[model samples]
Target: MTGSIDRFDEVVDEAWGRAFRGRPLADRVFYLASELGDFSVLWLIIAAAQGLRSDADADESIRLSLLLLAESILVNQGIKRLVRRPRPAATEPRPHHVRQPGTSSFPSGHASSALAAAGIMSHRHPRAAPLYYGLAAVVATSRIHVKVHHASDVVVGAAIGIGFARLAARVWPPPGER
Candidate 1:
């Protein structure tokens, strides 16, 4: 079973690598998105921007930031340690420079953090849910496009992130919900 899954992952990863690894526009977009997702910088920037709107927005932003921190620690430090999966090797020369994270690639920290942030932000800014999820999708998929994670890794990481956000919402609630 595990072998089959690994084979599937390899096939998909190779396909994605062939499709987008060398394209100029795709390289630029995915690379930028991947960079923005590093350490959840893009999400943090969004949270900071949201804070500038009003006191209520600021409160939500704080909650989102805190959740992101916890999510990062849990995913990057705790879960990645348990999984200990190595990142995908570059089969072909990369067209653009991309950061190679040292952590396990079973569950992408970038994807996990991105989805978690998106889920939380969506609750507070329901109208902007599309934007939140769209950014999350990009950040999550960028891991595969940049050849740092398997497709399964990103998918599972995204699931973990969504689950974490749901659990957080129940425990902490959003600003208005409480």
Candidate 2:
């Protein structure tokens, strides 16, 4: 069973490789899917929502948005500090991807942010839950597709994100109409 699972993981990785495989250019762009795990996407989403705030929903939006952002930072930073696991490329003899400058690479920030966004959006706004989670899946797959993180790393990071977001929501409930 373990061997089969590992083989499946490699097969999935290979399928992705074939789908996006190309010159270094193609590899580089496909590699960018890993970027989705970074904090930039979270900031962009927050900024866009903030920009479209209305007179009534403005307060609510700001409150939830701030909470989400804070939670993301806390979870991402805390896990990295705690795990400090090295990137696969650094340790493995035949790493899937190139080495990055970061010291550790246990839980991907990109995965964390994606998971947090998915969780918060899913709970705070049920209508957008599917979309947020769908996007999160894509980003998570991209990290593995790019070979920057392992399947387990993405999984754990996402779990952390969702957990943190849930905790934040309880700690700071969204604003209700007064």
Candidate 3:
């Protein structure tokens, strides 16, 4: 089982190297996109600022941000310890490939937070759903492009993010007025 998992990780890493890594322009874009989930704080700040415009909007943003922050912690600090999977090591990362998290890689925290934020925010503001989802998708994929996580890592992270967001939304309903 361990051998199979190692093989899978290796194959995915190889594919990522061929397709995404070493590409100058794309590497930079993906590196920046991944920062959207950095500490899950950027999204939180955006939510907090947006919340200032209207109470309902603000409420949803703050709620979603907080939920995402909690989810990020759960994935990064909690689950990652159990998984203990190291990140895909890039032999020679570009200048933009800056993040080097000293944590497990099975569940990309960035991916999780991005998806969670998207799910929660999209639920509150349906019209901006596409944008929220798109950003999450980019952040999730960027984890792989930057060699910080395997494809499966980001995939599972996204699932966790979406699931947690749904759970949070159901348990703690956001303000509704538009």
Candidate 4:
């Protein structure tokens, strides 16, 4: 299994190199996909800031909001700093996207933050978990599809985010004594 994964990585890297060669369209697509992930973080912050707005479960919403907020900060900053992986544009030949000045690519911070929100919301709202994770999957794959990150980066970031969200939920269950 491990060997297969290693081979997969090699194949992906090689394909990325070929696909990205002087391809402006690919670069633009990658850039757009990378920026799109940021929108989820924006939405989460907006929803949390706005609060529940008259829902009977306003208090529950606040508690979950706080959990997600903390998870976002911790997962994004911690994983980015700890892993410090370089972006594909930095190393991979003819990387498709424009490289951000200081964004390290190992375990994509965008993927981590998105997964943290998606995982927590999905777990808290089981019926909607599938949809949430499905969206998260799109966000994760976007990273690779753009060629800014390797498949491994997306996978690890997702694991870290999901693990962190679960831990946060466990340590700080929602209000109303659930």
Candidate 5:
């Protein structure tokens, strides 16, 4: 089973290898995704702006987002330490502006953050669930796109994120709901 999983990881990494090589547009999209998903920056910025303007639901969104992010961070770090899988080896010069993270690559922190934010936001704004999860998917795939993580890593990171989000939500529910 371990060998099969390793082979699958290798195969998927190889399949997406070209995108990190010379394809200009793919490189740009993945780079943007990585940046957008980093520490859940894009979502936090949007939530902050909305909160500053006193928009309805902004406070709850921000609170839930924070909770989800914190929990996901714990999960990501713990899982990474436990798994300790190395990232895929880059064959040649990576595309311009590709950043490599210096952490265990078994569970992608970016993917975990993205999914946690998306899971909480989906409940916060049901109408926007699709967009939230869509961005989460992009973020998860971005980890693989840059060859900083394998497919299984992002998938499990997503699960960890979602699980933590649900648990956090139960502990610190939104106002007027608990």
Candidate 6:
């Protein structure tokens, strides 16, 4: 089982290298995305913007921001500490500057937060669901493009994010819904 997992990581690393590592344009875009995703900065910005519309929007924005904070703490502090997985080694010099996260690489915190934000935001604005999820995809995948996380790590993180958002909805619901 360990051998197979190692092989899978190698294959994914090779594929990611071919797809995104050296290309200047992809590197720039993904590096920016990854940086923006740090500490869920992009999502917080969106939430603040959403808050400007009305009182209800402001309330939802506050809730989303709080949820994002909780999600980050849970994933980064709680889960990463338990997993204790090391990130991929720096095999070659990176084409762009990327922050080295000091956390376990088994489940990506950026991916988790992005998906959780997307899910919660989408519930409030169903018409903008595509935009929400599309940004989530970019933020999540950028972790891979920048070689900060394994594909499986992002996948599992996204799953956890989706689950967290669903549970949040059940417990709190949206502003209008019961």
Best by lDDT: 6
Q: Rank order by TM-score, top first?
A: 6, 1, 3, 5, 2, 4
By the lDDT metric, which is better: model 1 or model 6? 6
Q: In candidate 1, residue 77 scores what lDDT?
A: 86
The CA lDDT at 35 in model 1 is 93
Q: What is the C-alpha lDDT of each candidate?
A: 0.89, 0.63, 0.80, 0.65, 0.76, 0.91
Name the lDDT value of residue 18 in candidate 6: 90
lDDT (10s digit) by residue, model 2, range 1-178 = 7476457656766776677655566556445545534654543555357548665356655665676567656655676778776664423232235435363566766677777767755665689778778877777766765566666677777887788778767876655522
Question: What digit string (tens of lDDT, one per residue) describes model 6 on residues 12-64?
Answer: 88998897788999889899999999999999999999999999999999999
User: Please, what is the TM-score per model?
Assistant: 0.95, 0.70, 0.88, 0.68, 0.87, 0.96
Over 4 Å off in model 2, which ranges? 1-33, 90-103
lDDT of 2 at 28: 61
lDDT of 1 by residue, 1-178 (tens): 8798799888988787778777899889999999999989999898999799999989888888889989989988899999898888877787777888888988988889989998998887789999999999999999989889988899899999999989999999997798
How high is the lDDT of residue 162 in model 1? 97
Q: Kindly give the number of clashing pairs for every candidate.
A: 0, 2, 1, 1, 0, 0
lDDT of 3 at 45: 71
Q: Candidate 5: global Cα-lDDT?
A: 0.76
The true-versus-predicted C-alpha distance at residue 32 of model 2, in Å, is 4.6
